[model samples]
Every structure is written in C-alpha cells, then in structure tokens.
Target: MTDVAPPVSRPKVVRHQLERLIITGELAPGDRLAEVLLAERLGVSRGPIREAITALERDGLVVQIPNRGAFVRVVSEADARHLYEIRSALFGLACGLSASRHTGSVDIELRGLLSSMRGAAERADHEMYFDLNRAFHRTLLETSGNPFLAKQYETISRSINLFRARALTIPENVAASLEEHERIAAAVTSGDEERARSLGASHIAGGFARHLGESVVAS
Candidate 1:
C-alpha cells in the first residue's frame, strides 16, 4: 500500500517565505512582487502565491493596486510616526499589566533574555539582537494575559519591519536599546507599574527618533 502524505498549506508557507524575504531585505521596500516570478521561485502554483499576496496585503506588508500589481509596502515617515504612536500606547499598557501581575519565573525569563541580548550586542550581531529584542517584548506582552493586546502589537510590528531593520543597524542604537530593555525589565520585576508603562512608551519613542535620524542621513 502506498502511503499518503499529509496535505501542505502552500499559501501559508508561501506567505512566511515572502515575509522573511521582506524582513531580510531580499525583497526590499518598493520592490514589485510579480506573481509569476514568486510562483516560480517558491516552486508553487500562482494560485497559492496570489492568496499569499492577499494575506500579506491584509498584514500591511504588501500594497496591492487595482492594476499595478503587488509591491512591498514602503512605510513613509508619516506612517512610521503613526505606527510608533499606536505601538507606544499598546506597549505601555502591556507593561503596566505585566508589572501588576509579575511572578518570579517571569522575571527570571526576562533577565535571561537581557543576558542573551547583551551577548548579541557584544558580538555586534544585529540580527540576533533583533530576534532577542522581539522575544523580550513579546514575552512581556504575553505576561499581560491579554491576547487582544498581544495580537494588536504583533500586527503593528509586522508593518514596521523595514524601519526596525534599519534602526537596529547602528551600534550605538543597539547598546542604548539594550539599556532601555534592562530598565523596562527592572520596572516590571520590581512591580512598578507606572515606571514600566513610562519606560515601555519611551523605549518605542526612542526607536522612532532613531528611525527619523537614520532617514535624514539616508536621504
């Protein structure tokens, strides 16, 4: 008897691959995503690629026009500022909630992340640091015990990947960002809700400032 293989969700797989391409700067901002080309590259049918594109569009990672096809979304300065504002508020709330519900295990996990981030920074490994940074924030949000807040935070984070990739490239920014994370962790672990909220908001605001500075230098 021949064994039947489990069905694979091609569209979901394709979407993740596309997302990685964008995050790694392979697709890049403003790059046109041709359906046929993607289908060929990913070894999938164009139908799945089309569906993946639609999903990415809903995620704010791709822009689809009536006749122009799909392109990686180019987040403008205005969009960056707007996203940062929303993220700051959400992060503040998440931190406050986490602080009010802190546990010893949660504190230990956060400290472990901080240690990993320090190691990443010392090696000048921006990519590793970026992953660790994301994990740290996500862990705090999860501690909030509000799935809704975590979902919203994730959506906005995906939309701003371009800005983050550039912002984390600066060595100075890497060090400063780690320090901010340390302060945030300290506030949460110490059960200081107000301080955690303020530090969380300020951390995101600092990233926004750095993004603007980088944009200015680039342009």
Candidate 2:
C-alpha cells in the first residue's frame, strides 16, 4: 500500500499565525526563536517555519543574524515614534488625496467602521475597538487610491498592536481613542483634508507619547 503524504499548507497561512504570535506578545521582543522548537510547537516542519521567519524579517519584526539565527526585534518607544511619524505623513498624504478622490463605497465603509468603533467603545471592548481602529485607518488610506501610501500604511500597522494592548490598560483610553477617530471621520466626511491629516497625526503621536511616559513611570 502506498503511503499518502500530508497536504502542504500555504506559506501565507504560516506567516499569518507567526505574525499574530509576535503582535500578541506570545513571541516577545528579543525572544530567541529556534526553528526546531517552533516546528515542534506549531506541529509543522522546519521549512514552513523558516519561510515564516523570512516573511517576518521582511516585515521588520524579526532579525536573522549571520550565524546566530532569528530573534524578535525589540520595538522601542523611539521605534514606535518613528513608525508613527512615517505613518502620520503617509496617512496625511492619503487623506489629502482622498479628499479629492474618495469613492462612494469608501465613504460608506469609513462610516461603518466609525459606527462599529462607537459601539465597541460604548461596551468597553478593547479588542474589538482595536480591530475597528485598524479598519478605520486602512479604509481611509486605501480609499485614496494611492497604492504606495497603502503599502507604507501596512508596514506601520503592525506596530499598532503593541500600543493597543498598552492603551487598553488605561481607564479612559478607549473613549479618548474613539473620540479621536470620530474627529478624523468627521474631517474626511466634511472634505477637510488638512483637518483630517492634522488630527490623525496628533492622535498617533499623542498615543506614542503617552505610552512612552507610562513606560518611564513603570520603569
């Protein structure tokens, strides 16, 4: 009798799982990631693990030393701030472009996410609010029809998960963040690109600054 081989899963599936592990702090910054251990834990072969590592490296979440192997990159507040700065600029540009080019569907989608964010905030559901926050930003960025801006936004989006976890720990962060998003939505709806961009930048930069201050106090 011939032996049947197990079906191979796509690399993207492996990549996504690993991405979640990093974002949720399961695989924390500076954590050593051994291929053997990961393969065992994930119940997969080393091939997919290696591929996922490569993908993570491309996303700046992992760094592979010449001979030492892969380690999760520490996301410092400075790093977070830098990412937000870039995100702010790109987001601003996208919103400005969107001011003149937003499609009807895109506007509808943004409104829907805003509504969902309001619901999540009202219920104090941090995780759901976090997801909606991402959707709100992504929809706005993509709605501009600027593929380059969208790509940059995706790069910055990965860092946001860390902040979400931090913000949720604070008593009033959910309401404050929801309010900020509301301002952005209003600006976009009103066709005020400058207002949207300024508000968006301040919202992101303020969060990073607050997190930095909190980390210092804790330390």
The prediction achieving the highest lDDT against the true structure is 1
Which regions of candidate 2 deviate over 4 angstroms? 1-9, 122-125, 159-171, 213-219
Q: Tell me how far candidate 1 lies from the true structure as C-alpha RMSD in angstroms.
A: 3.9
66-148: candidate 1 lDDT, tens digit per residue: 88999988888888888999999999999999999999999999999999999999998878898999999999999998999
Q: What TM-score goes with each of the models?
A: 0.88, 0.82
Query: Taking the tens digit of each residue's C-alpha lDDT, what string does model 2 give over 1-219?
Result: 999988766677888778767765677777888999988888888999999999888888788999888997777766777777887778777777776666667678888888887888778776677677777878888777889889878887665554445555454776677788778777877788788778877887777665665432111
> What overall lDDT, based on C-alpha atoms, would model 2 receive against the true structure?
0.74
lDDT of each: 0.89, 0.74
How far residue 73's Cα lies from its native spot in candidate 1, in Å, is 1.0
Q: Give the distance in Å from residue 203's predicted Cα in candidate 1 to where it truly belongs.
A: 0.4
How much lDDT does candidate 1 score?
Answer: 0.89
